[model samples]
Target: MFLLFSCSGAFSEVVMAREKATGKMVAIKCIPKKALKGKETSIENEIAVLRKIKHENIVALEDIYESSNHLYLIMQLVSGGELFDRIVEKGFYTEMDASRLIRQVLDAVNYLHSMGIVHRDLKPENLLYFSPDDESKIMISDFGLSKMEGTGDVMATACGTPGYVAPEVLAQKPYSKAVDCWSIGVIAYILLCGYPPFYDENDSKLFEQILKADYEFDAPYWDDISDSAKDFISCLMEKDPEKRFTCDQALEHPWIAGDTALCKNIHESVSRQMRKNFAKSKWRVSRRDVIFLYHILPKTNSIAAATLHCHGHPHGD
Candidate 1:
């Protein structure tokens, strides 16, 4: 009943299925064994990052089933399709709609950064919609280029699309979650002006414009957009990575501050609810199986350390 999701990096297809027993609809992502076998470590990292997260704006992993080689993730599927298509058809968002979408996307990014996962690729294509209504919910999907930092060393990956990539990322400098915000700025610019701030027929010229950080504004577009919106985008798209607001800080910007209660609820866990579900599970395991669960986990670090089996084997799922 639904179309497949296709992008450059992911050969994996999205399949619509109904559970035989419950007759419930599911959107399943299939990564064939051959396609992922050579990239086992990356697949594991994606799974690890996705599992650590829980939020309304971030795509949820409903279940994960793995075979000897392939891995399948059943996720919450949004029916409204990608924001890129919307932009293509309608041109851009009005100020009111842009505010709502930015708030939702920031909430998701803040949660991910807090969990030590950097969504290396954040673009219009990666933002999915929940329905056709104007107030439709949004989510971040496609974890193929995501990464988790485990060490003190900063990451150095020449990834991300041209127009939205941060200066640090394009310069091949070590960078962090700030790169995602750079893309957010680009999105805001498009939403307000109905065009990207930087574009060129030549790839080199496009990179120059991105690094130059020059954006266009005319009374027609700028007069209607609030300063809070412009300032928030400017603060996030700052040239210096350190100066840019972390996802947490950006969520509190004047444009989105009123809705922080929505963000707070996402990180708050209901252990009581989880324990109740655990009791109902047919597959039982001992407390020892978990080894240990951290009572408190901050946003900047991980909840647990890597485990070593008695026979000297590394294991994490």
Candidate 2:
């Protein structure tokens, strides 16, 4: 067994190991029984959800083992690292590239939705590449916050990374699988411009911005991005979940399915913005702040319906 880096959760650690007979490398997530005192259901939920999912763009959970002290989850080992890091390292990036990546995510998400699963948390950090090879595929990981929507049930959990969260979720409303589509829109926005659509120094202000669907495609950064691409994002980020594009709709959008002739090298600008965003620690703070706020915020529906009424203009005007 080789000790890989630790996983994200406070209760579990992920390590890479080799199968004795087959010599196949795999990732083992070890969750201490003690740490699951009140959250045993969460672990069971994750296992149940992951076991039901099988897609090229989603990670696979192969086996499970339990001991008196810990439970080990064996999974596919993905070595390519985070999607954004790979994008930053690339010399050439374009809408076509972004479209391909988003398409994979959409495919995985569509499959999940078909299975009545909602990935509440969808963000760049959770997207990983299968390997370091050039042809590596993107794989969605980290299903800790995913929900299995059963028959006649509604998902009331307002759980997700703040900036990428849907407006309905921030409003403390019971949401549907549509929330995952909203997150994909946020990811698409970042992929095109190399910065998040909604951003603020203050957490409350950030939440407000997301709630109002207040985001813009600023100059220089978005000047070269395709109009069709903007339209695709706008449809996904619609304030009203009822109007937001489903995964199938997004996949069929013009930007993703239409022209692919304008694949320009956007690496310099994208990488520059990525470095700036990371250097300022905005993304890190947003992650921490969202978790803090998700628990402390009032459960009442405080956001008015008017605040959630953003014009879903295709051009993002």
Per-residue lDDT tens digits for candidate 2, residues 1-317, read 32333334445655555564465666677676877787777777888888999998888998888778777788887778778889999988888899989999999999999999998889987888888888789989878778888746577767787788999988989899999999999999998878888888898999999999999989989999888888899999999999999999988888877785258988899889887785565565223101100011122323211101111111000
Compared with the true structure, all predictions reach lDDT values of: 0.62, 0.76
Clashes of 1: 0
Can you give the lDDT of residue 83 in candidate 1? 63
Extract clashing residue pairs from model 1. Answer: none
Clashes of 2: 0
Tens-place lDDT per residue, model 1, 160-251, is 76677888988888888889888888776665555566767688988877777766655654555667777877887788888988778877
Task: For each of the candidates, give the backbone clash count.
Answer: 0, 0
